[model samples]
Target: MDGVRFGEMQTSELVVSSRANARVKQLRAAFQGHARLSGGMVAIEGDHLLEEAWRSGMVLKTVFVSERRTVPGIVPRGVEVVRLTEEVFGSVVETQSPQGVAALMVPPVRVLADLFEGAGAALILIAAGVQDPGNLGTLVRSAEAFGANGVLTTPGTVSAWNQKALRASVGSLFRVPVVGVTASEVAELEGRGVRLIAAVGAEDSGVVAAREMDFTAVCAVMIGNEGSGLAAEWMEMCDARVTIPCPGPVESLNAAVAGSLLLYEASRQRAVSKVSGS
Candidate 1:
């Protein structure tokens, strides 16, 4: 069990003892988000995320399993599987409590045009400068749950493939189209008839409340950074500024929470519009 190579391991596969092993090093780099080192593949831990990646038809490059655990049944034939010692596996993963299973997968490539392809009016969530990976991930999940056409992260927003964000998204990142674009690229959407809606704090006087806004139209809702909220640039670029009124007297809601509520409202309005038309 000690002298096994870090290549594909089966029933006869033994523990990979060397931290210097190529596969182990690759896994570490991927978890750290070194795009150059990871060959553009993203890392995901836990069986659930692994299974979700497989179910989502992600191009699984390799599955890394702890020597203490058997390779999961979800892994299809022909995909590379590497077995690592528990100690070495722990060192490579980000979680304090290593899940015994992890995998590297190629994230799906998408463009702004992809978001507008579907039949109905496009409902896109544009993350302007949201720094927190968890917040970005949650926004993607809500985007999917609320039937958004896609989620776009502009410059300064964390990457959707980030490890923490990927985990936080709970597999929705794989299903939802999360594309990265520049602020300039977003401005072009306005010309395409996609209205840009800015999410603002409740203190912004005269801004429409979430429930009252007309979200049935094609729109991109932009969530700003956690610390500074939306900058003047994005606010000015937006055709409308919408706020979520809070009776609790809080300054503002979390970025993810704000974005989720906005998406929910949009979803609700779309459903009502559909019913009315029918």
Candidate 2:
């Protein structure tokens, strides 16, 4: 009896079984951008995103998995791992095709000062009143592809942390800084010597065409509401109002489309400047 080993410690202790566990509850909230649950962490789902987080050396807070998955690789040391049943995982996410893995990560905290934190940034996108998450997400991705320093959003804009936005971003949420700030704060960006370009549907002389602008200078391009466009105050603050010269039956470009086109033009200008050393 003294030598009997009935209760040897098992490695399975690392695995969690109950769906009602606090960690699972936290993960559920994190999926919805709850700061308390996420603890300043960015939630990412699917193997591809997890891989992206890993390869980027981002610190992971916890990893959640559905019942059917196998451990894919060596999780970083000190990171917590959670396993759940498929039903449990489904309840935690809004997706139909659950990839069975997710991670809570700490994204780099960026501020307005960080915009010029590095040398020679030419453009940034200010999503002033974009209400749709998908549109906001697309803007972020486009900003990155077009070499913008970051994407900033004013109050009343839909959250970039939104699940739909996260999916639409295709991981650009992690790649680019999407920070939310107040309209008053945005007005100050112009005073800081960051040229503010507001995109408006109608102006007296019409908005300057993207092709003729010099994006090689530090600037913040503002894209506003789908319905109302930029606020009157925001419009008044712009160094220039810019528009994409469109020749179509369409009244105007979608907010994301207009923003992306402008960003690409900015990128083109930057590229040309470097080539010609101007």
Candidate 3:
């Protein structure tokens, strides 16, 4: 497909064969948080993610395709496309089976207000100190699937833009409004009249069962760290604490599973309420 034509679209001037090349170095840096901050872009590997980014209207700064692959027509006009030697491309990307395409994109800028743009009795998911990128990504995907208005991450939570998180999100990251916030900022949700619900282990006594809570109210469900559970300060801020009923002997649900279940319950409650009203 090397001869594939783009009518009048412009192509990159040089083929990058060396891993030491400046552009290659820049791509490598984009994989790291600090480096991404310096470059102001994130590296998304594989053809699927690149396409997802494009479909979501993410600004593509540059596209890198491996020597063995064809440039996908999905790439927008005027975007710089760099062809890299297979060996060099492998060296620059994290995925073992590189889809022969990747792109450096400007991470979407989002504010707390964006989460509530059209929200009425909004459902928001808050990841508080959840360190696993995969878990965080799954929660983000579930957030969108279950009709969440948006997702917010606390200071200690992994950035949803992390490469592993991005991949695990299965492109939902692009579609969901995810923004980071500090502990102080989280307090603002309460001021906005949104109920803060804390999710705890099923073993925890004296907590309301997940399904028993009224999720039809404007609410944000907070999922805490995998190991330590929610911080004391966070729990204190919650309007109510809830636990998913576990019939098995397992100590607790996985963070992602727990969060997803809570979201599903919320969606169910909201749907029922709407139907009953109608």
Candidate 4:
């Protein structure tokens, strides 16, 4: 295909119409998590997400735009832009309405120490086997909004890079540091002077209300799976367990809602303590 420049913007070089094309296959594989094993690349769709990825300084591998859509100017020079026919783009993406734009990006590399780099006291969120991608994505966004240092996902948790999770995060996934860890690794947070707080659904005799927790200090709040709640062993590792009080008929809050509430409370307390100089 011949390149067509838009004003001064760099142009696309190739138009892919075949589903069997190697680059098209790679995009699909990245979305399906196959590319992740070999190249650690994740496919992000929509123009907004692509812009967010660029603003966050992520390295873009390739950009794919449907034939009907113009290449976004935000795409940097020297990056390869592949224009795919509408049919091929539809086949490659998971969304009901393909956004006409997608890009493969390298997921950020983070270490455990990166979570605690500069903060005097850290507020961390842990996702323990959170199977729902939407919930996990919301938790990641909430973690950043509430000033959490970073998020840690246990081995069984849904990947923060999952396309559903990425889309649900509304680009906050690119802004926050999410690292995977083993259960044992999670237990080690306590060694660094970070208190472990488990978020449970209903009130228990031994558990404290979320408001009562001293969030101003370094703490990591652990949010569990949607269906089963936290594993008993994981809860046992926590310095304390806290629950949100609900007077209504519902048995529990959604995992993301519960986690976000806890994070907001933490943020509120920390802000108050900072203002009071206490």
Candidate 5:
């Protein structure tokens, strides 16, 4: 199914009706973000994530289909598929209305080198300390949508695979590589000639307007938390500071919005540079 499926496929397998079933319990725990209980498998519901997971070639631990729903065509052969009763399935899924499908996929292990492997110049989005799951997810979405090479999350940021963030990203998580790093690791980027640009408030003095900033070079745009913006330490590490000029009367943009805007500006600049052979 292309979208959320409500009992769209018919399966002949027996339905798992017991909430106490071992696998069901594990699924529930996964939905609750218990990485230990779920053995580090990421739980994803809805048809869109299922399709994206398959498209991205993620390792599927199991695919749970609501009773009467058959395995989606998007699921590859030899993958374990289970059928769950409607009542039991709804209990485990975070969604008020379960799309009658869910899956547990192994989160890929990535190294710093993975982020720099592409032929194009590295354009990574850094989440310094953003706490909102949806915002983190949107940042991942924006990174991929704007042709960023990857997303790097600092120690204090929320998990990029949070349920709210996952749904908010609309399946971008499966396609993008998200790496969590420590403060010292982030500092090492500067040693590698990667310019760190701190996104600051509109009123910040000495900050370049995003459009005027050159994003063609290798750079990582850092987005801070919702309340305080970037810390002094992060700001100190940045080679430059950029602010999006908002003509309207607004104090600041949301963390995700500011990051997305910056990424879009970077993409625009990169596209121009590519076309003009600069």
Candidate 6:
């Protein structure tokens, strides 16, 4: 037996038929973002993503595995398990090589308040209108790697739930609470005592050179669109507008590159501050 013989499994094991099945439709809808899972639930695909979600301690509502693929590793004892035909599974998965495992999980409900729980400085990344999913995903990965508090996207930005973004994020999208709201709402984060630093292209003097910033203070670094850059109105809301001092002739950096640089600088400053005890 290939360890796939359902005869040895519990009678309650679900074998889904018909791509039109209700559960199949729901799974497909989630990929399309048509189904916003209720009560904090989220749809994540692939064995790797499912493993990441499990390791992160998110509650798994159900695990969907393709009949042809090997059974994925150990799962929670009580998690609902559903088996799907290889063809049906392919239809719901976003990638060309479906990992044969996916899960519907409940994301831990987080808020702006949840991010500021620990002591010391708060580092945040604000993305205005990054249309490219890869950029958003790369930025999120950088934010987590560089220790950003959170990532907030403006209304015009791409949906973090989009399959491409989620795929590119490589599971950081789940690690970080990616919030989507308006530019004005970003100000509210400041009212609660975060220092807003906006990156602008015009300023010759970079805003407190990222290395020079006092990461000990709560801070939010705002990065805008690739083409038009930051809007005048949004930039005005920043406590200070900063730019990366580039010695090269390049007029600008990609949105993700700029944001990653800023985040790494913030992380470096915080690490130094901790060591120096200043």
Best by the lDDT measure? 1
- Can you give the lDDT of residue 125 in candidate 1? 95
Candidate 3 residue lDDT tens string, 122-211: 899999999999999999999989999889999899889888999989999998999999888998788888999999996456689988
> What TM-score, computed on C-alpha atoms, does each candidate reach?
0.96, 0.89, 0.94, 0.94, 0.93, 0.87
Query: Residues 203-255, candidate 1, lDDT per residue (tens digit)?
Result: 46668999988999999999999999988888879999899989996999999
Model 2 weakest 10-residue run by lDDT: 2-11
Task: Please give, for residues 161-230, the per-residue lDDT of candidate 4 as tens digits.
Answer: 8899998899998888899999889888888998999999878788999898888899999999899999
Q: Alpha carbon lDDT of residue 15, candidate 2?
A: 43
**Which candidate tops TM-score?**
1
Model 5: worst 10 consecutive residues (lDDT sum): 1-10
Q: Clash number for every model?
A: 0, 0, 0, 0, 2, 1
| Tens digit per residue, CA lDDT, model 6, 79-140 | 76678878888888788888788877766666767577677677888888888888899899
Quote the lDDT for 160 in model 1.
89
Whole-model alpha-carbon lDDT for candidate 1 = 0.89
For candidate 3, what is the TM-score?
Answer: 0.94
Q: What is the C-alpha lDDT profile of model 2 across 31-104, one tens digit per residue? A: 88888765766678888878867876677877777768875584675566666767878878767888988877
| Cα-based RMSD of candidate 2 | 4.6
Task: Name model 5 segments beyond 4 Å from true.
Answer: 1-12
Q: Write the number of the candidate with greater lDDT, choosing between 1 and 4.
A: 1
RMSD for all candidates, in order, please: 1.7, 4.6, 3.4, 3.0, 4.7, 3.9
Q: How much lDDT does each candidate structure score? A: 0.89, 0.78, 0.87, 0.88, 0.87, 0.76
Of 3 and 6, the candidate ahead on lDDT is 3
lDDT of 5: 0.87
